[model samples]
Target: MPKGSGKVLAQNKKAGFDYFIEETIEAGLVLNGTEIKSIRQGKVQLKDSFILIRNGEAWISNMHINTYEQGNIFNHDPLRVRKLLLHKKQINQLRVDVKRDGYTIVPLKMYIKDGYAKLLIGLGKGKKNYDKRADLKKKEANREMARAVKAKNQF
Candidate 1:
């Protein structure tokens, strides 16, 4: 019902750590026959994948969808560049953002929603090393606090 809320198949955990996600948009994938089958089987990987805007169209490169076992001869390429179905206005907006604002388009997650494959893409800016270190420190502090709370509850 909400953005990124679906039967998640794969996620790029590194994206969040490496980039500051400013906005997210759900886009449909133009998959081949066996590609959808493989995705529905949860045999997909979003890691190392990124969204590229070329010729006023959006494409996702390096997204891996494993070949379907049953689709021997009809199997699709595992790492093909798949087209993303976005509206013309959305594509223009993303292109402008990437070209002008120095933002990178990263694929956040892949999921199946209502029998269709969807990709959650975000407009992100790369984080510096200091920012990453700060985030790690904050995460560690949160973990320690949670542990203390749990230990206190056990008493």
Candidate 2:
């Protein structure tokens, strides 16, 4: 109903911090009417959300799209395993990579795309402890450099 106003309901910032993302794919969600309404109300959580290829199909688990407060007995489960719309070839490739390479599928973000709720899923590998520390240090250094440049330019 809104023009050029695609709303991003939620995001999984921890996914990027913990995983080395390899590839990302946009997949549509299978949601009910009430679920979509709740998402539009911005009541969703992406923490601990993950993807898995099961029985030749992809499903998202641990995502909590809160039920509409006004909805009654027909309300969907908050943590239901929602189906992800992906191609058969993509599913096969994800299955192979996850099973053999010790990789994982993590939800990067959830956004309203073209008036439909979509998920940006990433193929990721767990980062080591040192890797996390190094990344933190790099970010701090970049921030310090930017601050110094700003201070110098202010004069």
Candidate 3:
């Protein structure tokens, strides 16, 4: 399957509006017991999460996985930093892009595939104000055209 093709759990919708995504990579998450339980329940949030490369390893921060209700004492922290499983070659490529080309690694989507939790991360460059405006305008035009075509076909 392609990247981002799975049972989606959460998504960072604002990432598209704020950055221009260049490439996407699928990665596995290192989650604890209760954390995976909560994720399976669809109680996860990736709104403000971001990826950071440190000590040649990739880690995700600010991702929220609500504590499992059934677990009283064995629950994991809701906002703990989770490590990302990636190849050394992939980590080095991402680090180079971030340091040399001003690219940022942003979490795009989280999902479950083959009974494992997967995260889709993107290499993106920050978009300017004018770019955002232009994108909005283009989106509006497309919506209008679609509406017109639909109405015509209904006659």
Candidate 4:
């Protein structure tokens, strides 16, 4: 999901509907041992998560990575602010771009690639109320058109 080909652990479906995504970047997560294990087990949620660039560093906040069931005292926190690995230049660029009005960083999905946990983040502009309605209407029209085409082809 969200352009990732690997095993997708979690995804934020609302992110796409709420914002106009300008660009997406895949960044590494600084995860705990148990956290990665849980992620590999597909025990993660990105619905309420977001990305923020602060003090020249990127952080993913409110991302929930459930604890490994077999782990004991060394279990990682389910809701923790994890650091995102990005180049300094990319961070600077994000810092500059995020200052624009209506622009914010949102996490699209989380997946594992090459045995590492990767988070896909997007630079997005918040959509207006009217924009959301128009999008929904367009989607419905497209669906109707597809259905009509299918019926015609079947005749």
**What's each prediction's clash count?**
0, 0, 0, 0
Q: Which residue pairs overlap in candidate 3's backbone? A: none
- Write candidate 1's Cα lDDT for 87-148 as tens digits: 99999999888985558999999888888899999999999999999999999999999999
For lDDT, candidate 1 versus 2, the one ahead is: 1
Candidate 1 lands at a TM-score of: 0.97
What TM-score fits each model? 0.97, 0.91, 0.97, 0.92
For model 2, the run of ten residues with the poorest summed lDDT: 1-10
- Candidate 3 global lDDT: 0.95
Question: On residues 1-155, what C-alpha lDDT tens digit does candidate 2 reach at each position?
Answer: 33213577898989878999998888889999899999999999999888878789999999999999999989999999999998998889889889856599999888897889988888999999999999999999999999999999999
70-151 per-residue lDDT for model 3 (tens digits)? 9989789999999999999999999999985658999999999999999999999999999999999999999999999999
Q: Could you give me the TM-score of model 2 versus the true structure?
A: 0.91
TM-score of 4: 0.92
Clashing pairs in 1: none
Write model 4 residue lDDT over 78-123, tens digit each, in one string: 9989999999998988888889999999999888888899988999
In terms of lDDT, which candidate is strongest?
A: 3
> What residue runs in model 3 are displaced by over 4 Å at the alpha carbon?
none
* Residue-level error in angstroms, candidate 3, position 3: 1.3
